[model samples]
Target: MYIHFIAIGGSAMHNLALALHNKDYKITGSDDAVYEPSRTRLLQKGLLPKEMGWFPEKITANLDAVILGMHAREDNPELQKATELNIPVYSYPEFLYEQSKEKTRVVIGGSHGKTTITSMVLHVLKYHQKEVDYMVGAQLEGFDTMVHLTKENDFIVLEGDEYLSSPIDRRPKFHLYKPNIALLSGIAWDHINVFPTYENYVDQFRIFIDSIVKGGILVYNEEDLQLKKLVSETTNTIRKHPYQTPEFRVEDEKTLLQTPEGDMPVSVFGSHNLQNLAGAKWICQHMGIDEEDFYEAISSFKGASKRLERIAETSKAIVFKDFAHSPSKVMATTKAVKHQYPKKQIVACLELHTYSSLNAEFLREYQGALNAADTAVVYFSPEAIQNKKLAPVAEEQIFNAFDRKDLQVYTNPEDFQKLLEQQHYEDVVLLLMSSGTYGGLDFNKIAEWIK
Candidate 1:
């Protein structure tokens, strides 16, 4: 089938384009701008648009469908033309659903841990020689692409995001899947710009739960009180399976799982990940994987990229980078590093990068989020705040928000780097938490300098 992608340079959109290309479907895509990795990958596949930006002339009726990305605005010329020509336009999630309608869809959703849980399930399934169409948000160790779709797979694993589907489609992406099986890792208020209130944000998850097929299964994280309450209150006919953090011990900086066979060593650590593992186990079991096989395969899983990933290590120092920006995620990631290396000094540095993180009102929600770190530093750029059209966030506001008298704050990237360079590296765990680069700092160079 022939498909044209509108604003296809998006991380998820590019992956889907590559997946369709690999599936022998005729794929063409156009974007106003394409950045690294997406640009390189698209060029490699010869799927890169000959010219950038949308063109109304490209929206021909002969195209089977036009896949829309969130990057495209509502008034995009191509999208307008597609509508004028009466050609079908599908949001990326909608297109994915169309492709997997015949397959058993397993969707993992939450405010966080969705990517990790989905990656774990995919890793275990791949290890067992199971064939499945899948889409994960992050780049995993062995996966060629973040998305893989095929005609022969009987099942599909989707990393369900709770964010809006597209500019034209106001529904959450997860709600479009209508999964046969679903998992909720946990919930924390996010996307404050979109949802505005905690209750409004939670209503999205409720809608997602309601979208599950009749008699389908929902595996959830019982440790999350809010999520637990939601699942308990749901009267849907779907089966409910709840899980918590599994029994595990940290030994010599490594986390080991207590199993009947023996103590198995796992590459990923922390209570959040352990909780994610338990949820993945339930999904895998429902997919026909035995408990023993799940345990064995998970023991070898090295974690999804940038979710508590160890970027550099030495005899006396270890540096970790994570995509943690929300208050709950910041707290969990900080606690995880501290718990694993109790004897070492913890220096947790976080960048206020997201729209939610930069908001003064939202700042109050981060109270005590970084308490676990021995030394905590928060950094934000005034330039970024202005660029996003957000109110200026004072360093004093951040200092008070964390409720840690000792918290250090920086509005200048240079000062942040200098402070980082001056820190003592002896027996220390350096945790860098952000959804963005801390103002374009080269992590590898910094790691080498620290070493």
Candidate 2:
């Protein structure tokens, strides 16, 4: 098949392109601008666009399909050209679904922990030498590319995101999956830009629950009251299973899971992670992995990229970098680190880079999120707010929102960097949480600080 990608520089889009290219398909892509990693990866695969930006003249009717990325605007010349030529155009999720339509789709969905849960499922399956098609949000340790597709695999594990599928298609991406087997980690309000109200954001999950294939299985977190309520109220035809945080103990900063056989130590820690692990276990069992094999494989699962990933660690101190910007994520991450090392001085730093976090009204959702940290710091760039066209958020608003009088806020990245540099590493847990880099702070330098 011959395929052309619109906005192929996207993380998911580029991965799909590479997956297709490996399958002996002729793949060509275009993007206005491509950033690091994506740009280099595309180049390595010999799939890089010869020239950046769209070329409407290249959109011929002979092309089999055009996969659209959400970053591409509806008015993009390439997209318009493809439409005019009557070539089929599929959104990223739409294409993924089309390929896996015949296979059992196992989609992991939630506000947070979905990536980690999906990664865990993939990790367990790979360890057992069980090959299956998969799409995960973050890069895993064993996976060369984050996406894999094959006609032989009977099942496909997907990290189903609730964000918009594409610029032109406003439906949440997860809604398009229609999974035969689905897992909802838990729902929390997010994407304030798209779903303006918290209630509206919650309704997306409702739609997602309804979209599950009839007679399919839905594994969810029972501990989450809101999620439990949703499951109870749902009239979907799928069989429902609820999981809770499993028994575990933190021993010498190591998380030991209490299994039916015995205490098994796992590389990943945190209450939320434990909950995610339980959900993954249920999903894995449904996929034909036995309990013994699931436990054996999951013991070696470290975690997903940038989700409580340990960057630097020593006997005295440890530093972790996490992709946590939303209120629930920030709160969970901060508490997880603190719970892991009760003796250490917990210093948590978060960057408000997302449109929701920068909004003054949404800031209130972060109330008491950083309470677990001995010292809490929040950083935001005024330029980002201006670019997002959001209202200005003052330092006072941040302090008030978090309900922390002594909370330190930084609008300048240099000041945050300096503060991190001067930090004493001894008996401390430095947790840096952000989806965006703190003005491109060099993590290598911070890793070197573990003395």
Candidate 3:
């Protein structure tokens, strides 16, 4: 197979490129600017472009397919050249569907917890030596690439995102998968730039549920009233199974899960994580993993990267970095951390990154999200806002939005750094939540301080 990628340096696109390259497909890709990890990985794979810009001359009639990434615009030069040559173009998700159409597609979708749920399922399956093709949003410990593809695997597990597939393709990426087995963790309105309204953002999940194949299986989080209501009311003729957070308790700072055999100690904790584990167990069962095997494997599951990941820990203090930017997610993470360490007074810091979190209108949704923490701080880069071409968010707007008078807000990285350096770390847990690094804060320095 001969494939060309436009905007190939994206996190997802680069992973897919490496997967296809490993499959012995002739792959070529172009990206104007590629960051670390993606740049290093692609270069190591010999798939990195020699020069960084789109070259229409690279597109040829011999190419079998052109995979378009979300980073590429409709007017991208290489995209135009491919279109002019009448080459078949496929959005990233569209191409994934084309490749896995013959296999039983298992898609995990929702606004929050999808990545962790997908990682948990993969971890259990791998523990049982069950090798199946998979694509997850975050990097798992055992997986080399975020995406894995094979011709022999009968099933393909995918982290189904509700985000747009490509600049030119307005549909949600998950809609293209048309899964035979699907899981919806929960829904929280996001991507305000595109969806514009909460109602419109929710309709995407409704459409996702409708996209499941006839007689397929649908697993949902029953505890999420919004998701439960949708699942109970859906007319789709698919088998349904609902799951909630299982019985668990924290003892001596260890998360223990109650099983038929006995109490099972797990590496990961938090109510939200426990809920994610429950959802993963249901999906694994559908994929032929028994409950006993699921619990056994899940006992060692650390967690997906940046999903409440412990960066540094000591007898006195611990630090967690989480990829939480949405209002619901922020609240869930803050509450979870507090629940796990009830005796300690924790300091929580959130970085308002992502387009949705920066939107002036969307700020109100985050009201009281960080209330669970003993000390809550919010930071956002004005430069980032300007780079996104968004309206400048005022300090007054931020205060009114969070409704927390004591909320310490910083508008630049220097102030955030000073805040981190000046903090005393004894007897307190630090929770840092953001989709992007807090303006390139040296995490190692924070780890040293916490230690």
Local distance difference test, each candidate? 0.93, 0.93, 0.93
After superposition, the stretches of candidate 3 with alpha carbons farther than 4 Å from their true spots are: none
CA-RMSD of model 3: 0.9
Please list all clashing residue pairs in model 1, or write none if there are none.
none
**Worst ten-residue run, lDDT, model 3?**
442-451
Q: Per-residue CA lDDT of candidate 3, range 1-451, in tens?
A: 9999999999999999999999999999999999989999999989999999999999999999999999999999999999999999999999999999899999999999999999999999999999999999998997999999999999999999999999889999999999999999998899999999878998898899999999999999988888898887789999999999999999887889988999999988888889999999999999999999999899989999998999998888999999999999999999988988999888999999999999998999999999999999999989999999999999889999999999999887888888888788778999999988889898889877766
Backbone collision tally, model 3: 0
Tell me how candidate 3 scores on lDDT: 0.93
lDDT by residue (21-89, candidate 2, tens digit) is 988999999999999799999999898988998999878988999999999999999999999989999
TM-score of each: 0.98, 0.99, 0.99
Tens-digit lDDT track of model 1 for 1-451: 9999999899999999999999899999899999989999999999989998889988888999999999999999999999998899999999999999999999999999999999999999999999999999999998999999999889999999998889999899999999999999888999998999999999999989989999999999988899889888888899999999989999888898888898899988899988899999999999999999999899889989999998988888999999999999999999999999999999999999999999999999999999999999998998999999999888889988999999998887888888878877999999999998888888877677567
Off by over 4 Å in 1: none
State the displacement of the C-alpha of residue 115, model 2, in Å, after optimal TM-score superposition: 0.4
Candidate 2: residue 86 lDDT (0-100) = 93
